[model samples]
Target: MRKRLDFLSLNFLRKIEIRYRLINCFILVSLLPLLISGLLAYGETSSATQEKVRVYSMQVVKQISQNLLLRMEKIEDTSEELALSDRLQNLLTDYYGSDEAASAQARSGISKVLLDSYGSFPYVNQKYILDRKRQVIDPQIFAPLANSVARLAEEAPDLNGRPWWTLYNAGHGQRSLAMLREIRFTGNNRSAGLLFVGVRPSYFFRIFEGIDLGYDSSIFIVDANDGAIVVQNRETGPGNADPALQQGIAASLAQKRDADFIAYTGADKMPYYAAIARVPHTSWLVVSATPSDKLNADTRSVRNKILGIGLLCFAVSLLLSAIIARSITQPLKRLVMVMKETESGNSRIRVEQAGSDEIAVLARKFNEMASKLHQNKEQLEDQVAVRTRELERANRKLEALSATDGLTGVANRRRFDEALATELRRAARSNKPLALLMLDVDYFKKYNDRYGHQAGDECLRIVARVLQKSSRRATDLVARYGGEEFIIVVAESDPGGAIQQAENICDAIFELKIPHADSPFGYITASIGVAALQPDDHTAPERVLRIADQALYHAKYQGRNRVVLGSDTVHTL
Candidate 1:
């Protein structure tokens, strides 16, 4: 038996003996623990640090967005006040009068007022008021930018139609964000002049002042509409931003207006993390960037130290490693089981252990990471839910507005068609009568010519309110059928009832006593036509509409301000 055992041991220990082999295996196994410990510690610390940096960057970007938005809103309010200012309106009104001395005085007074107002706002760099004669109201004060103004006017001759409300970066440091408004007469609402308000680019980009941006980090403002770089701190830092990188980032952000953060590679061939935010009520973006190498510096330091110590321990622990390695092997097996459980969708799983061993520290850190991940997921879901609700509410409001008229605040033609089709179907099902009345204001063209379009709109609104108030049935619908005409559909009403309803609507308009001087009648009145039908499946809905329209013409022909009924024969009331 001794001879057989010696032979077997010799074969097994050809390269090394069993004891030496066990020690070597132990040292190899121990290296894994050290490696894992260093990696886990570095990963936890690095992840935490990066998360903090990202959160801080987001806060900074959001604050900048809000500050810039507030500044813009202030400028916008000033523009509004200037547009409606009576003094400025009077200045423009008397600008072209025949008195040269008064005109000079008015120009002087206007320039002084603009200078005072513009000086009061330290942020505003320029202001201009151009009258209808294409003359600057204050040319002496704004002569420095005369070429730019002329170029702008040449580029857009129709400034009255499409007001410029964005940043303009004409080279030679003449960059400004402008708000253009049209000045109108208070009495006639006629365009008198143009009001131009502008503030330097520094006014918007000043939010970055005193911010503790890390070395080599950059912050910029981007135009969301055209992907243009509005402001940037690239010149102050290392010149690593290439035009391609900027263009790529701007294009990406312009397309993805919803994302708050995005990752990209910079021109320096380094990975970067960017935090982005949009200015409220404006098409602009605020972005900040940090290098990934800086974020991972501590991890690299820790890893290098662990590698040095690990190599030294590999040689030092070779002799006593066999015994020490057994102790950790069992614990590592248990940790592996716990990790497998977590890997199988059991994120709540945790290792049960005590003492300051590496395994114990790893278990605690793992549990912490799991908890944080879960919290972040829940927060993301909550934000998604909030955004979805906002979209749904916005859609509902759009639907309501689309179904109503812009001028009269009543149901529009689209809503009328839908109501008419639905009522026809319901009446056909139940065999009940449906009555439609078409109403037209008498001599509306003459009324519009006499009082102007603004007053004519008011007159239509008053008539609409009266019609809407008179048709107060649950199933009754009043809609603006066409220009200066309205349609009222009364469910379950006969011809007599329909004519009486129409007469009541006409009398209601008369009682309002809106003056229509061109009409033969001294007061505003409506001519209405009534058409009743018991809808059958074969009868077309448009036929009833046509009959009602023809009856309205008959009412107008039989002298306005009367109700006409349509059936086999038309009759006047």
Candidate 2:
């Protein structure tokens, strides 16, 4: 009986001990900390997600605005360039009251340039030039708009000598955007005529290509002066465009409320997040609207996840608190050290995932993150290097194309002008003599008349090669001044050396034996004018060019195939 009693006592004590341990665990692990932690995590994650969405939406709107501004600026710049071009200006200035052939020539040059410029920009639907006589150079362009709006662009008092934008109705309720620029003679800076550019609404479709936001989100451009939609995304249709929403947005933007997102309530009583950015150089605003529910959807998902994670962590902690002991501390410390190492620019550092517990999972995630970061760093570095190299190559190619003539493979007129100025400056400073040779094919117009223009071009190319070979010094420059006209600059050369070089150039062309039935020699030949001068600091490069030109005329007058010094003394080659 005593043994049976002792067994019962032992069983009772064991039951009590089990109950006590259960109470202790519950008290120690309590749901309070879990609820508090879940709430904190939910709050932090929601705020972060909301902030990120806000920033991302604003960036999208700003990017759209920047892109629109860039295209507008390009158009504006092209217009400025066309208006300021000397050849085009001369053509336009002479277009009025000119003969048919002259007018035809002017139109040809103008059209070629306009088409080439237009081809680079597909957004420009239609381009035309309205001359001083109010005649459209190109027929397919809008003549009526050119006659009316183009004139307004030139004479309107409200424009303040700036470009004007208008919306043209293209029937079927489709509208097109138009920019009108007043062309002026660069010589006089007075209004000469107008340049017209048209852009259809289709441009916007391509402008927003590859750009995406969440559902029910839309971006559009509107006139800042008046709330008129210039371009709208597909989502912002007539149904979605609420007058109340528009007015509220306009009001918010008018107040210059902030350079970030604003809260707006639409007519349907649904709240929206709106962002606005101004399109540079235009009275347009890029506006983006996102539904509040959609914007917060990510935050809501994070909140639910936080709650679940907190619950799971609470259960796991309760089970492992006593056994985990100091194991968690060491790995966590190691993880912290590795993170510090990664933060200190060592993305190759990784944590070991020794087990399948939460700590091990965390370590595995850290390792994965580090590996991805390292890969991304390498990839970004490679892309940057490649892009830098490509950009450098593109820039070099552009520079070469800009400075070199295409037809003759020599310096272009612009490059010649630049080099002449620099060389003159150098000679003036060093007190040295510089020589210039200006020459043209004898009876070149007759050559073009006898042979076709293509033959004439080939002859000119061959002549350029001969001139380049004659000027052997590295400091010498050979350039095509214009059609059938080439110029050579001999650095640090006296008049005698220049005359010798000119004679050589003349003899080389004569030896080519190219067919020129119209010439006195019955072969291709050249007339060169030599000008050498020790120019002072005040000497203009134009003065040297003018002297060379005068000598060239004297050479032509004296004989067909000879060289003339600056003093008009002829040297038979």
Candidate 3:
């Protein structure tokens, strides 16, 4: 009976292995076609998406460039109109008058001309005259030009008989693009002065309408002379130029060429694709950028769809595999359940086979295997538990040794230093006060020599206990700081409060009365130094420690058994 059962079990196990192999083969065969189809689909979609993105980006660039050029032309035309205005001509003649009354009357006439011309073109902002000396003749324009003339004088000393256009950084939150045209008066027909028309940035920014770029996308015009951004779409807010994008745009301007579609970080530290084009008529560059993800949205959608189809094909293959695997695994499921129950100390379950195939043979062998596994499980569990407990104990010992001071049974200097740094950082960020106390056992070496090394250990333990008890707050820490020295960190305490706490700890250690007959100082006690820190003193935690250490050195120098406070003069021990 046993032999027959063994043979049946072997045959059933062989049939299960065969079914597994067959299912694997089916999966491979099915997946190969699906994978190939997915790759081909993804490749086609990627190509199509890239092409679409290229076409769309090029179209956007062209449209934006045309729109900007048209706007610049309109501004140029308006500038020409101001240059030819009869009123502007009359105002320029009066502005160059020699006498104070004549100059005052000229200023009045020019202000009137500006008010009249400003009504026609609200974007004019201001209009003024530069005299033969290139000095601003209009009081309204004098403020921005007064300091700027010194700078411009260095750049261009002889501004006579010249028609020049330049951009200037106007004070009072304005940037002016000015055009200067040399004018000859009707009487002398000699160059008398220059006519200047200042256009505000809003005049150009008004053209950036009806564009559907993403919310983060921005369009800006920068002055080529100094690389300061002159005009940008106001809707983008101020300081929206990311340094990386600014550098890229500056490079493009320096090279005097358009940049490729490149990824860059924006002012907000978000990724974007940037392209720059130089303006034709001025020393200015136009930079247009959109979020990189927005530019590739269509491509991502197509790629997602292709991946989705691939997943669907994989899902169908898995479903078919489950159905085929179920036929061979049905009997094994019951056998597994019986085996699990047997493992839980119920070993009387008998295997039942549904068919006369190899499954029947496997069923009989499963019962015997379950019996053997059940017998060995207890011993295996015992060994595993013992090994786990030993490992856990070793880990605990390692952690304890890592944190503990070998000599004093308190936290070591390493742990104390880490805690002090962390607490100092926390106090700084929270704008709170923190204090440190340095304590040293008085005449520790004498005590060690009198009562031996074992007694020295007992003395350190007693001092550590006193320090631990004195510091009651959860934020307070007492640490053994090398041989015969200890330190305490007290958080959220002021100088006076820290001094009292340190004195209390000193008295506590003195009360312990550890024997030190051979010591220069009578009973065993500690000299303590206290220092407090405020939020503004961000110099380092170690600096505070150095201050406390200096105070402690003074304490030891004055006497051996008293507490000293940190101040302008270190308090005596």
Identify the candidate with maximal TM-score: 2
Off by over 4 Å in 3: 1-51, 94-103, 140-146, 149-167, 173-190, 214-216, 234-243, 250-272, 293-298, 311-573
lDDT of 3 at 434: 88
Q: Predictions ranked by lDDT, top down?
A: 2, 1, 3
Model 1 misplaced regions, further than 4 Å: 1-30, 40-52, 96-101, 132-135, 141-144, 153-165, 169-171, 204-206, 213-215, 225-228, 232-256, 302-573
Residue pairs that clash (backbone atoms under 3 angstroms), model 1: none
lDDT of 3 at 306: 72
- Model 3 per-residue lDDT at 41: 71
* lDDT string, candidate 2, 1-573, tens digits: 645544433332223333454455567766777677767877787678667768887888889988887777777888878778887787786675458778777776676567556634546767778776646786334455556555544543344467777665543455678777778877777767777777766676656877777746887887765567788877343222457656766777678753557777887788887778777656677878888877777777777787777765665665333333234455678899999999999888788776545667788988888888977887899999999999999999999999888999999999999989999999999999999999989988779879989999999999999988988788889999887899999989998888998998999899999988988899999999888989889989877887787788668756768899887566777
Choose 1 or 2, whichever is better by TM-score. 2
Q: For model 3, what is the error of residue 477's alpha carbon versus the real structure, in angstroms, after optimal superposition?
A: 70
Candidate 1, 113-222: lDDT as tens digits:
67546744546766777776545677354354655654454454455433456666544545667766667888788888777777767666567778876835678877
Q: Give each model a TM-score.
A: 0.43, 0.44, 0.43
For candidate 1, give the lDDT of residue 559: 89
TM-score of 3: 0.43
Clashes of each: 0, 0, 3
lDDT of 2 at 149: 50
lDDT (Cα, 0-100) at 184 in candidate 2: 82
